[model samples]
Target chain A: MSEVFIFATLNGLVTGLLLFMLASGLTLIFSMMGVLNFAHASFYMLGAYFAYTISGVIGFWGGLLFAPLIVGAIGAIVERYGLRRVHASGHVAELVFTFGLAFLIEELVQFFWGRDTKNYQSPEIFDFALFSLFGQEFSAYRGFMIFIAIAIFAGLYVVLTRSRVGIIIQAAISHPNTVANLGHNVPFIFMCVFGTGTALAGIAGVIAGPVLTTFPGMATVLGSIVFIIVVIGGLGSLPGALIASLLVGLLQSYAIASDVGMPELLTLLGISFDRNHPLNDLWTLNLPQIAPVLPYLLLVLVLIFKPTGLMGNREE
Target chain B: MTMLKVSNLHAFYDKSHILQGVNFHVNAGEIVSLLGRNGVGRSTTVKTIMGEVEPKGSIEFKGEEIAGLKPFQIAHRGLGYVPENRDIFPTLTVRQNLILGLKGKEENGRWTIDDMFSMFPNLATRADVPGGVLSGGEQQMLCMCRTLMGDPELIMIDEPTEGLAPKVVEQIAVLLQEIASRGVSILLVEQKLSIALKISQRLYVMGHGKVVYEGTPSSLLEAHDVRAEWLEV
Candidate 1:
């Protein structure tokens, strides 16, 4: 039981960190544009699909290198031609455009990838076990994922905080006018940031697809969950997203690992429920059965109590 | 020859006709002030010139029509605008904000970070601090410095001393005089006539979107009726 708890916790931490990868990009986009991207998860799906197709022709490593490039290019083009055109219409129109885009991308995936789950298996190089803890082997691919996520996070932090381009991007988010006055091309920067953010989402999707399953509905499954993570962490707060992802991951993992349920609570409270009762099903619900809803529950609780999120300075 | 010429400029916000057939001209190396009461379209005129608003007129800078250009495009063409609100990037440090204006790949390369810092020493100390934390006077200085980083042939500053301490306003007047001395044409949109008169070589009193009066700052000071009717804020 103890081993299961520890293993589940570790796996949850991994999952949460990966989710943060998607959420961070979404929050950046939101802070700059002031619109939550409804199709952020769709970009993730597109990344996975792009990788899947590329890996077949060029191998897994090459796919990892090229897929995000392709995805980022597509995102840039979309932002320049589509989002920029619709910006004058206000935030609702932008949100709707992304929502419609999410739907269209899902359909596009079905048309191109043929409505079936692609065998997006991990690379042969990372198929072996990296190490074993308490008689359980940690797959090399999962370990690779942890490394990539951390590296990307560090790289993003540096680019956003240390480099000249990063400084311009950060400035553009708050004072695009000032940045432009400094002889910088603000619109081009916006296009680049949007592209980079989408590409990051794509990278996350590419690695997560094999483990999480890649299909037409892959985007639908994780789309809102990423938003939830971002909102729970606080909009535009990088550290908050990291913290929230881990919190959600651990909470859900514990919920799944523990065997306690409503029955245990009921037994402890000395309450007896008849099988004939109309609410019998609710009383018999198990901890594992409710694990999937934990994130949404936390999201609601956070929204109610702390609207700015865990670290967000601005309210949604 | 005029560095910038505006002819029959008309602008609207929704259905409101804010700038009603405005016309103006700024010669090179002159500090021109646009004086008007609140809600009289002074800021609107500036926004229109920067392409931050859709305006119906012709605005030519360096002899090219730029009324239809976007804000970024206008800035790319050696035109700098310090908006009424300053609009400093809150998340970015002062140095970063200053550097942001240095994006154009132009040859003239007029202003540098050191130039701005030299002009505003208070900013040099807060180079690492975000613009959001600065005092009103410091933020105003940062906004001007940020614009100067663009190396603009012309700079349109809206209300440089609208809300500030008397000392800060005095500092701003000195800064404006210094900037004007550097051969850059500056359009100072100000409510404070005394400060504008002190720095600007030329002045235009605007009312209902039209340039009601234009002359040397001495003439504007002499015209008591125009100041009373159009600029007695």
Candidate 2:
């Protein structure tokens, strides 16, 4: 039992930190632009596919460095030519534009990479076991993932709190027109921010591709989960995103690791149902079976109780 | 020399024409006030000149045509605006707000953060606090000081003393004089007749989107008919 708990925790930490990378970018873009980029996960998908192709030619390290930059440039171009034009038409137009962009990107990925999953693998340098716990080995690649996520978070916090550009971005988030009047090019700032955000997502994709599998359908699988993390964490709050990511990650990890089931609960409550009863499926349910639904359940609870989210202060 | 000039300026909010054929100018080292009652397009005139509102005429700043430019472009060319609402970034610290007002990375601006703190010690005490926590008067002072950080040749201030205490209003009046003494031109949009009359070298009385009368402060004091019709409540 203790062994299961330790391994679940380790796995949860890895998953939680990975989710934070994607959530941070989504929240930043939303706060700055007032529009949630529905195509954010699609950009993540692009990163993985780009890394897969680049790594095939120049090795994984080369792909790791170049893929995110390529994705960031594409993000900036999308903002400049696509999103900016629809911005004048208001929020609905922006939403539709991004939603359509997601579909367009998925199709583009399919056209370029095909439907089969690519055998993207972690670097050979981290192929060895870092440590053994309870006779089970833990790979160093997972440790590397955790390190990258923490570094990104620390770097982001310092830039926002202590740097000049960070202060400008915070000001632009609330009062864009006022920032522009103060002699800063706000539209240009928006483009850079959008690019940086997608690039962050690209980084997540490059790292997560090997662990989570890289395929055209990879985006569709993780896209909604990323959105749920942001909404559960609060729309545009960074700290909230980190907290919510860990909560969901741990919850799913524990559920999958544990063997607890509805049958045990029913027996403890002195309730019994026939094998062919209408609700027998509910009676026989186990924790792992419902792991995927746990985040959504948490989302509903958060929305009902704290509509502003855990740390969200802004009403809009 | 003319520091800022706007001739035959027209602006609209959707379909309604807010500024219709307005004309005004401020010479170097002059304190010019645009005075009128509410809804008389006094704020609209200044906003149009600052490029916050779209204008359909000529706006020449330091002999360069600036009409049809974006707000930041206009600001980069040395025109600063302190909006009527004092739109402070509420979440940012007062010092951070002042830093954002700096044009680029240049630190040799005529006004520094230290100068602002010394002028308004209340802001100095609350320099690290968020702008939202400050009182109405302090926000106004911070707003004006923020614009001054950009070191503009001409600053357009809209209703700086609109909702402040008498003592704070007096401080702002003194600050305006101090700013002008440093050779920065000012175009003040004001509702208070006495303050406008006392500080402004020249005054323009606006009515129905156009300048009804333009003259020196003393001449406007004697023009009781113009004041009663366009300015006085």
Candidate 3:
């Protein structure tokens, strides 16, 4: 009923859906290759920086189109030259390689974009407020973000489930030999899927960069959170990633919006803590302050209780 | 003409040699059985031929040197191998598993999925089920079918009937003979002398990794001293 509550919920949904976009691709790539790419978020960062660079030249829409294309091409090369070479060494080495790649991308971003957040503005057409919800203005760009994320998800779903290429990709994951036998190149297929996955992440970054603040630390901020959404949702399941993202988004959104703390609960329960007490910090702990950590806590719990993930097959 | 030729072959797991100075050959459309007791390098011989092991010496398939080729490359060059464990992709459907082996190189093979389906109707019945769910005999059938889909020029099946029911083993024996009759060279590694004798035109017995005995099935059956000496029960 309150404006603050409605806006927070709306914003939470936007954040959640965007997170699903990244997690879905990461989960699929992980399932197929058995490699958790730590550099996935770095690709997202690259997308933002590329979009920022191109928006000045070809404009916002063109940058959105071209940035992911360039980033995806780079992703394919990374898979071919970096991941494939390290594959024979073992999965752990491959994981460490991606970790190193993530670090490298951060340094590269700083070298190119500097340590400051870029002036990535929303396009002029969507600059105006769309409507008033609960006496508060709802921005058109936020609504546009929701639309774009949904469209991408729907498009990806159709491609993966209904298209012929999707069938080949799925077959490659389960029976690469069979696909190869049927006259498909398995390695090339893997490279394409890896490229597409990273590209999707890049798109997510391009779209969210303006709202989220496109700084060098953008990837670092969202990296672990995206992994939390993926692992919690269930690795390799697109729908699971979607549900988990929304669940996380809304949960954090509501927590941050709501005014609740240990002190308040303690008072309600007829318990009091002295200001000079050793556990004063613990007494004053609030949900909003710790909202960012809920997904990670859930990730740990999922790993402990259900290692296969919420909707995934074991050890995929 | 020989489909597969091996000379003074030696193979090892790490340091310990398993296949020692073994000389063997299988002609096109021929059924040559490698008959030996357990731990006589029968399985290792097949593995070496398929490029699963780094064998020391020369192996030629269809006039091409093939001792050092990768498994997929070897498979591409028309050498089909049915591993002892059956290594079926467990999570995949029976059809998916079979298709994985069909490497599209068989321009004119005697076997097709339809042909294999007709031969082993059991596989067709459970086409949608995961390979792991199949019985041991069924898994062997799936393995054989998978390899057949590849349409290899020469097939090396390692111990197809090692752990099957007697009836199932008999069916597999029949299948091998039927396949051999259709002009596909098969180098069978079998512990069961009866099954091997039923299918093989010729046989070789190995001891300590070297071929010590080679003869026709009847000759092998009749020569008790050769059986008791080189085969040694």
Candidate 4:
């Protein structure tokens, strides 16, 4: 039991950090632009697809290096020529634009990469196991993912808190007009932030593609979970996102690892419902069976108890 | 030489016509005040000149046309604005706020961070504290100092002493004088008649979105009819 708990924790940490890589970018963009990019996950899909194609030609290292840059350039162009135009129409328009962009991107991906899953694989260097614990071997790639996520988080935290450009970006987040009046090109800053954010999402996609499976629906699988993490963490709060990601990751990991469920709970409480009861499904439910809905359940709870989120200060 | 000249400038907020044919000019090393009651377009005039509001007429800065430029472009060309509400970045520390005010990476500006700290010791002690936690007066000082960090040739301040302790207002008045002494022209939008009368070399009374009265401070002191008609409640 202890071994199961230990391995679950390690796995949860890996999953949580990967989610942060995507959540941080989404939160950054939301805070800066005051609009959520509905197509953020599509950018992740593009990263995976792009990496698959690049890795096929030049190897995994080349794909890892260049896919994010390509996605970032695409993101910048979308902000400059796409979102910027819709911005004047209002917030609803911006949301719609991103929503449409997501569909367009999905269709485009299907057209380019086909509907089938690609044969993307982890690098041969990480194919070996990093260590053996409790009769199970943990792959080096999972450890690598955890390391990269930490490095990205540390780098992002430093740049935002300790650098001059980071200060300007922070100021712009709260007061774009004043920052512009102070002589910083705020629109350009917006473009760069959007680009960088999408690039971060792209990096997540590159790292996650092989493990999660590279397919047209890869984005759909992780996209809603990313939104849940952002909201539960508190919209536009970096630390909130980090904590929420870990919570969701651990909750799901533990749920899937353990066999505890309604049966055990009812037995412990000395209460049992008739097997023919209308709510038989509820009595028979198990933790792993509902692992997929745990994050959503947490989101609902957070929204009910703390509407502003864990760290979000904005009332609306 | 004219540091800023606005002639026949018209700005509309979705056809409300906030500023209509407003004309004004500030000279080098001089402090000019725009005085009027609320909704008289005193704030709109400065915002229009700063490119926050779209202008339909001529705005010449140092003899160069700057009518259609963006706010940042106008700022880069040596124009600074301190808005009425003191729109400080609340989450940023006072020092970070000042740092963001510096134009680009170079520290060649006439005013430095140390200059701001020395001028407002209250801000110096709370340099690491977030702007949101500062007192209203401290935030106002930080806003002004942030603009000063940009080192504009002409700075337009809108209602710098709106809500403050009398002591802080006096400090702001003294700082304005010190700023003007360094040859940075000022276009002040103010509500308090005494501060404007004391600090401004010339005053423009705005009414119905146009300059209704313009004269030296002493001359305006004697113009009771102008004050009663345009400035007085």
Candidate 5:
């Protein structure tokens, strides 16, 4: 039981950090453009498929390097030509534009790669288990993912806070007009930021594809969950996103691992329902069965109580 | 030499003509004020010059046509604008705000971060604090100093002393004088006639978006009828 708990925690940490990689970009783009891009996860899907193709020719390392570049360029083009045009139509139009974009990208992915799971695999070099705990082997790749996520977080922090371009970018996030008046090209900055954000999502796709299994619906599976993380953490708040991601990740993991459920509760409370009763489903409900909905459940509760989430500055 | 030449500048906000064929000019190293009441297109004129609004006339800066250019393009061409609302990047620290003002590394620029701090001691004390937390007066000072960091040849400042204590207003007046003495031209849009008369080398009273009165400060002061008809409440 203890080993299950430990491994669950480790796995939760890995998942949380991976989600952060995507959330960081999403939050930054949101704060700057004032638009919640619905196509962000589609960009992640593109990264995975692109890497899958490139990895076949140049191997995994080469795919990892080139795929994000390709994705970033595509992101820049979309922002320049597509998003910019829709911007004049207002926020709803922009949201619809991105939502349509996600569908279009998904269709394109299916057209090229087919509606099937790609046999994306972890590199052979890190196949061995890092350690054996309670007779269970912890694979080295999960540890590698944790490392990459932390490195990216650290790199993002340093670049945003300590560098010259970082200061300009930060200023642009809060005050694009003033930054423009200071002689920085505001449109170009917006393009770059949008591209950089998608590229971060691309990185996450490249890394997580093998573990999660590269498929057509992988984006749909994880995309809304990432949104839940951002909302739970706080909108447009980076630290908030990070905290929320880990909390959701760990909560789900622990809930899934634990066997306690409605059966245990019924037994403890001396309450039992007939199998044919209307409330039978409720009586038999289990934590593991509802683990997937934990984030959404929390989201609803948070919205009802504290609409701002944990650290969001902007009020709805 | 004329730093900015505006002739027959007309501006609009969705069919409501805000500036109706306004004309004005600022010369090198001189201080000029655009004095008018609220809604008289005083703010609209500067905004049009800054390319924040569409203008249907000539705006020649340093003898080059700049009427249709974008705001950043105009800014890059050595034109600075200090807006009435004082739009500072609230999340950034004072030092970061000043740093954003710089065009590039200060190789031979007149203003530096240190210079900004020394010019406004309040800024230096709150160098590490975010701009959002600053008092209204300090934010105004930050806005002016930030624009100055861009090292503009001609700065169009709108109402620098509109909402400040008497002491802060005095400091701002002194700063403006110091800015002019350094050979940087100023186009000040001010509501207070006393500040305008004291600081302006010349004055233009804008009425209904046209130059209703344009003269040296002494000439404008002597014209009591013009003062009552166009300026006095």
Candidate 6:
């Protein structure tokens, strides 16, 4: 039981960090541009598909290296031609533009890659188990994924806080007009930020593709969850996103791992529900059964109780 | 040398015409003030000249045509603007704010970070603090100092001392003189006629988006009717 709990925790950490990779970019873009890219997950899907195609030619390492670049370029073009044009129409228009973009990209992906899931596989080098605990083996690729996520997070923190470009970007986030008046090309900065953000999301898709399976529906499956993480962590906050990602990841992991639930609670309390009860589903629901809905449930709770999210700056 | 020349400039905020044929000039090493009431288009004049507002007519900076250019483009061409409502990056430290003011290639401007700190000791003490946490006077000082770091040939400062303690206003006056002494031309938009008369080499009293009075400080001081009709509340 303890071993199961321990493995679940480790898995949770992996999932949480993976979620952070996507959330960090979303938060960064939001802070800078004040617009949430609804199609962010579509870029991630493109990353995976791009990587799969590239890997067939030059192997996984080459695919990993080039896929994000391609995605980043595509993201920059989209910003320059699509979002920037819609921006003048106001926030709703921008949101609708991205929402439509996600649908368009999905159709494009299916047209190009087909509706079937790609046989995306982890690199042969990372296929072996790193260690065996309690007769269960953890793949080295999972370890690699965790390492990459941590490195990206650390790198992002340093780049935002310690570098010259970071300071300018940070200043631009709050005072764009003043930044322009100071002679910084504010629009150029916005374009770069948008590109970088999508690139980060692309990287997340590349690594998670093999583990989660690459398919047309992969983006739709993860899109709402990623959006939840950003909102739960506090929109436009890096640290908040980090905490919230791990929280959701671990909570879901533990829930899925545990067998305890409504039935167990009722049994402990010496109360029994009738088979004919209308709330039979609720009465019999276990932790594993509830795992899928945990994130949404938490999101609702957070919104009702703490609308700014755990670390969001109070809205003006 | 004439640092800036504006002739028959027309600007609008949507359908409402704000600056109607506004004209003004500032020479190198000279301090010129645009004095007017709240809605008399003094801010719009500077904003239009800074390329914040799209204006119709000619605006020459150092004899180069600058109308219809983007704000950053105008700024890159040696024009600095300190807006009426001081827009500081609230999250950034004072030092970082000043650093952002540094030009890309020519970083060694006329003013150093230390010079700004020494001139405004309040800023030096709060150098590490975020701009949002600073008092209004400190933010105004920071806004001015940050623009100075860009080393502009001519700066158009819009209401540098609007809502401030008397001492800070005096400090701003002294700083403006220091800026002029360093050979940087100034186009000041001010509401307080006393400060304008004391610091400005030439004054342009604006009413209804046009220059109602343009004269030397002494000449304007002697004209009671100009002050009574246009400047006085």
Best-matching candidate per TM-score: 2
Candidate 3, chain A: TM-score against the reference: 0.96
User: In model 4, what lDDT does residue B124 have?
Assistant: 95
- Evaluate candidate 1 and give its CAPRI docking class based on DockQ: medium
When summed lDDT is taken over every stretch of 10 residues in candidate 2 chain A, the lowest stretch is: A307-316
Mind giving the per-residue lDDT tens digits that candidate 6 earns over A1-316? Answer: 9999989999999999999999998999998999899999999999999999999999999888999999999999999999999999999999999999999999999999999999998899997999999999999999999999999889999989877789889989877888898888999999999999999999999999999999999999889999999999998888999999999999999999998989889999999889789989989889998898999999999999999999998675
Clashes of 4: 0
Give one digit per residue, the lDDT tens place, for model 3 in B63-149: 899888766677878888887877777766787666556555342556777787788899889888888999999999888887877
Q: Lowest-scoring 10 consecutive residues by lDDT in candidate 3 chain B?
A: B99-108
Q: Model 6 residue A159 lDDT?
A: 89
| Candidate 4 per-residue lDDT over residues A119-161, each given as its tens digit | 9999999989999998999999999999989898889889998
TM, every model: 0.94, 0.99, 0.86, 0.98, 0.98, 0.98
Q: Choose the strongest candidate by lDDT.
A: 4
> What are the DockQ scores of the candidates, in order?
0.51, 0.89, 0.19, 0.91, 0.73, 0.73
A44-152: candidate 2 lDDT, tens digit per residue: 9999989999999999999889999999999999999999999999999999999999999999998978888999998899999989999998899999999999998
What is the lDDT for B183 in model 4? 91
Write down the TM-score for model 6.
0.98
The list of candidate 1 runs beyond 4 A from truth reads A176-183, A272-278, B104-108
Candidate with more favorable, higher DockQ: 2 or 5: 2
How high is the TM-score of chain A in each model? 0.97, 0.98, 0.96, 0.98, 0.97, 0.98
- Best of the two (2, 4) by lDDT: 4
Local lDDT at B105 for model 2: 77
Q: Write the per-residue lDDT of candidate 5 for residues A248-309, one digit (tens) a residue.
A: 88999999888889989988999877989998898899999999999999999888887988
- Candidates in order have lDDT scores of 0.86, 0.92, 0.84, 0.93, 0.89, 0.92
Model 2: docking quality category: high
lDDT winner, 1 or 5: 5
DockQ, computed on Cα atoms, for candidate 1: 0.51
lDDT of 1 by residue, A1-316 (tens): 8899888988987898788779878887887767688988999999999999999999888888898899889999989999999999998999999999999999999999989899998898998988888999889898888888888788878988888787777767776765655556777877887898899899988999889988999888888888899999998877888888889888888888888999999999999889789999999998999999999999999999999999988843
Per-residue accuracy of model 3 over A199-291 as CA lDDT, tens digit each: 998998889888998999999888998888888877788877888899889989988988899999999999988989998998999999989
lDDT of 5 by residue, B2-99 (tens): 99999999999998989999988999999999998888999999988888888899999999999999889999899999989898888789988888
The lowest-lDDT stretch of 10 consecutive residues in candidate 4 chain A is A307-316
Candidate 6 lDDT at B161 equals 86
